[model samples]
Target: MSHFNDFNNPQVAALPGHLKQFIVDQHYEHYTPIDHAVWRYVMRQNYSYLKDVAYYPYIPGLTKAGLTIERIPDLQEMNNALAKIGWGAVTVDGFIPPAAFMEYQAYRVLVIAADIRQLKHIEYTPAPDIIHESAGHAPIIADKDYHEYLSYFGSIGAKAMFSAQDFELYEAIRALSILKEMPDADEEEIKKADELVTYRQENMGEPSEMALLSRLHWWTVEYGLIGTLDQPKIYGAGLLSSIGESSSCMNPEVEKLWYTIDALKYSYDITKPQPQLFVTPTFQNLINVLEEFANTMSFRRGGAYGLTKAVESKNTCTAVYSSGLQVSGTITEFKVDKHDNPYFIKTTGPTILAVDNKLLKGHGKDHHKDGFSSPVGKLKNADLPLEDLSADQLKDLGIIVGVQAKLDFESGVTVNGTVKNILSSTEKIQLITFTNCTVTDKKGHILFDPSWGGYDMAVGEKIVSVFCGAADKEAFEEIVYKSKTETHHADYDWKTRELHKLYQQVRNCRLKQGDYGFLGNVWQKLQHDHHDDWLCALEILEMLEHEHIEPALTAEIRQFLGQKATDEPELKKLISDGFYLIAHPVEQNLVF
Candidate 1:
């Protein structure tokens, strides 16, 4: 029998190497016959119901994505089908962090859970499974407009960081998802997980931006309706994937409301079918409402609200203090001290005295015997409303809002210039700069929106690089790192060396090929070593089939064939994973 713990650890260990942390392998062989049977059962049943009641795009999208009611779909293979439409699928181990999930979508990559629900949870699994992720979510990406909206939503959603309390809510839900999927979890563990979930629900105050966005996703992407209230069609992934939900959601008993931004008012329970749903008249309306709501978020609207959110989201940010020093970090907290002092916030990564309260000046020094202080008055820097300041006034304080900004592509320099027209889009900030243009050829033309390059920014804030000619996004990151109160060091060379060693090990495997011993050794690393090397092993195995080698080397390699070895299914399957990749390479595109 399949165990819940197995589901919790369903990620195919070797796939998502360092750069592609969002991906994993499906480990197709791990699925039991029962798993495939359940998939077929659900697909066959749901297809009939969906064809009649589902949204027009649902069926066509599914077909375009090459999904069929046969067996459980391989995410890599699905990516192949999705490739024609400029999208790709990647497998994940159950649920990942919400922000991470959004980031993947921003890159046009679909994150699908690798595990299939057990027979017992066929109707609905509180935990995400292959059926929910691949079947429910993947098909919709086939629609170009819908795909754009989904990714745009992800870009905005990624910006909504959580408060410490709200982050706890996120962690609690993550814990619950894992615990509920742990087959051997004792009664005590279950009790603890249940308490956390309950606590999060009971204590949650006015929904944070992250929470509200989640509610919107649940209503629309997960269980939404489209068309008129009287003649609604099933479009939500939750409804399309579930035979039970698909049929029940459209029944007269369920309350259907026209989808609006106000839908954020209602909270949802993932454990049961939603009692009410919001229906949209058209897909374009979804994008409009989403973009409008996103603008109201703290990241888009600079000031205390924007800074506070950036801190909670743990996004690296640059801020100027009254004393003129700038600092950036993976911000951990944004709160007033007990003294009701709101002059300074706290950071965890590289501790520095941010604001000196006694002197009332921002200090960039690493040492802080008397704790951090602010360079500017608390009210002036963060407490003041954003609307109170003009573009030039904010610019004087080193704050760049929507204005004609000078961008130095060569030096990565950006500064406030003159005010120009502002443009709007679902994914990013768009604006035209005039008068003081450095790019002579494109003067009076629109500067590129940084969001197109995945640069996280405040609502009205335009990026002005301090460095000259550093047009790439790396230049922007370098500016933040350089401005930090202390250097944040990472040992890149050492990490690269270790990865190179793993590649050498894969190369060394060719010498021990007797009875597939070389393959088994690769299997061991795939199971035990770090993920970065997993891809190297797969690539090595994929290449070994045709590479000519000494016959003597082959004979010597066979010596270990008679050695007894334990048969671990996962390891055994991993040894052969290369063949699958050869057939279906994960193809991803940069959708800026």
Candidate 2:
């Protein structure tokens, strides 16, 4: 409740004069002691588990980002570290829109949420927080390739568009997050917020272009893994940040599928633990699959295809069809025929246009709205009412008689009865034709006789549940997170922090004699596996060229430089200059 950044002020988000309104100050002082405690507990829990199991660069990236267990990180201080590695950090109140977030990523800025989850939600927070953003995402940004991959992915993702319905879901997410963050939010308010989320999800229907892009984002960035399925390691931010889900996701029972382009077909749920995780063999594989997936999207191509892609990408746009007709609006609904192919695009402007399976232009299906489920059981085959039908006439028209029918009552309750006849309304505004049915009370006495009459509500009869509809299948198989109580510690043998410090010293020309052996081992370890880390070791060798250096070590440096050096011109120059400095003791003015 402390007014950090004046969070309680209704106009705080509208503050002017900033480079971007979404970026906010960390407001470190606003976090109470309990908040700090939660940060520490979650950090310690996650770091201990991730130091060994997470992506190879995560621990080093954490240390290089200048983060510690001491307190929550100040974005400015974190930026100081990130700047060394060609990245930076920024803070936001909570979740930003998908496009805004991707745009930030494209610019190499981490969009961290300033708030921390309360103790009750320590294991997971549905909203973005310091733990999920800084602790979860920051550590891996230090790696050159992984960071570049993020930049490329973000650039492609920034072009995506979404339907108006998708925006509604996003707004619901923002609303729910704000409600959860409120210090005095009551249970009733929380339930209402949860229901809003559920309503949005239910209405989203099948995967649209934007939804598919989100699925890709979720699988790789949120809950992705790296390494072979038989021996997957945690790399995704979701696993890197969570205490419970991290350990749970790595269990053998969880389905660890090999990361492939087909991974795009899957959908995920944020409310539950993932039942399946896609594992890439390396960070480079993430880049490969992402590029492949991006190529398949229509938005990047621009056209009718691009139009769909634009809608998929979460942007509202004005586009001209081949007929030279232009339409501008947010896409609201989409539908496919029974074959599960896209057949129509509906906009909130109340416009519906038909597009073939390949997204080619087609005339609007005038009855497109009829495809949707309606209160009157989606009137089909005939526009006329089924009233004034005798028992024989009803049977002739394929109307099933003697079925239990449900009707909305005046008291907001639904009651069922056996159908006897059909009748039409005579009122000026005839609500709906009704079926005469026999209604019996609990005592088995018939309270009402069967008769045709005008009714105020639409009537529907319960039928056998059909589960094979195009959209009836579960979007994603439910995943369970089985929590563990055991505390974890960093596997000290890996020396993530030590390697980070050594690398920094090399960058700063501060390496000492005692560090040579460790540097030698690190160089050897990185030479075959990591081009970037190997280059850092070479830089350290270049810095070590001095008068006081031992002849044996100098010889070792020269030998490795000669045999393992690449044809890269900059590397060749660094090596040539390093040997020259070793030769001319007084001419040691060159920078490392």
**Evaluated with lDDT, which candidate comes out highest?**
2
Error of 1 at 317 (Å): 5.6
Report lDDT per candidate.
0.54, 0.55
For model 2 the local lDDT of residue 215 reads 83
Candidate 1 versus truth, CA RMSD in Å, comes to 18.3
Which one is best on TM-score? 1
Q: Can you write out model 2's per-residue Cα lDDT over 1-592, one digit (the tens) per residue?
A: 2233423222222222221555666768766544554665566556555667887655466777767653578766687777778777767767676765675677777788888886567778787889898888888888788788887877666555556576678777777777776656788988997998888888886655567777877888888888788888887898888877888887877898988888877867677799899988888888888878776655434333554454553333433332212223344444333443332333442222211111112212232222211121122332333333344544554544456555432222333454544423331111122346443433444433456232222232111111100110011110111112111112323444455544544433432435543555555554555444323444545545643454565566567676544654444533453354335432112111
Total clashing residue pairs per candidate?
Answer: 26, 11
Model 2 segments more than 4 A misplaced: 1-19, 308-315, 318-592
Candidate 1 per-residue C-alpha lDDT over 294-387 given as tens digits, one digit per residue, 9 for 90 to 100: 7787555544555565555554444433232233444444434344323334444432222211111222223332222111122224333322
* Model 2 score (lDDT): 0.55
All candidates' TM-scores? 0.56, 0.52
